[model samples]
Target: MNNADSASQSVQTMYAERFATDLTDNRAEQKELTAQIERLRDRLEQLRTDETWLTGMQAALPGETAPPRPRRAPRTGRKPAETDAPAGTAVPGPRPAGRAKARPSRARTSVKKAVPTAAAPLHQLIRALMPLGEPRLVREVHADLAKAHPERGTSVQVVRNTLETLVKRGVVGKGIQKGTAMYTATAPAASEGDEAPAAG
Candidate 1:
């Protein structure tokens, strides 16, 4: 009876040791698998970031053919002269030789000041002041007109609104002076056919 009891105890110790070793091996394997999963997640995040950056770059850039690239003017043995455009060929680049002084830009052409006889009273008043030959502020123009022509009784706001309208109409030139708007009257150019008759 004593021998049997001792053997049973030894068998129980061996089983406990085997169970502990199996548990340890399983834990190690679990730790290794968890680390591998974390690495994959980090790599996925990096790839997503790169993809987002690439998408943004693509959005900001113009389409490839937006402005057809200007072909390089073919090189010739002799450099062409300013006036030496070869005949019968479309100038192969951005600008053709002697571009007719690019028609004055719209902004320049439109800045024509004319106070016709039938113009609004405010416009006529502003035009009359053009003889001052300098840009004037809205406040200054308003004060002067009020003082000189009491009957007009124009308000400062009226002057400002009128000035803004005149600027849009190209009848008045607007400039910035000392960070404030300054207005100047522009005279319409006389047409070529309307030249004054020569005095005898």
Candidate 2:
């Protein structure tokens, strides 16, 4: 009976040792799996970051091959006026009180006069024929002007350019017919004297 009890005790001890060995192996496997999962997550995060950076760099380059950049609205602020003065001309600083106002130098004044001279003839011709309702082709206007003033000898191209100038100045209306542009004189605003009396 004593031998049998000792044998049973030894078998129970061996079973406990085998159970402990299995628990340790399972713990090591769980740790290795957790480490592999963490490494995969880190790699995925790095790939996402690299992809985002690459997409941004592709947008900045020009042409159709690259992704389009976000379009910004055009600036609406007034542009600085260009001066007619020569490149090296020094702009005068503000004068002190009681100092004589600096007269515009001859060159500057002549440059101003020259600009008006180029535009004066065109303005005069358009103004003389104000409020014309009929749409006139550039060729017709040129022919009429040449016949009326044989000395001027203005070319058809010059007349077309003048008509375009009038359109820009809001003195004439321009329209397209079969892809060819036609111009009609726009009437001026009626003054108080020109207005009709109100009916009772």
> What TM-score does model 2 achieve against the real structure?
0.33
Q: Summarize candidate 1's per-residue lDDT along 32-62 as a digit string, tens digits.
A: 5675566556656644443433332332243
Question: How many pairs in model 2 have backbone atoms within 3 A of each other, for residues 3 or more apart or on separate chains, i.e. clashes?
Answer: 0
> Alpha-carbon error at 26 in model 1, in Å?
85
Residue range 130-192, candidate 2, lDDT tens digits: 446778787677656655444343556667777776677666789999988888877552321
**What is the Å distance of residue 99 in model 2 from its true position?**
54
Residue pairs with backbone overlap in model 1: 113-186
User: What TM-score do all the candidates reach, one by one?
Assistant: 0.33, 0.33
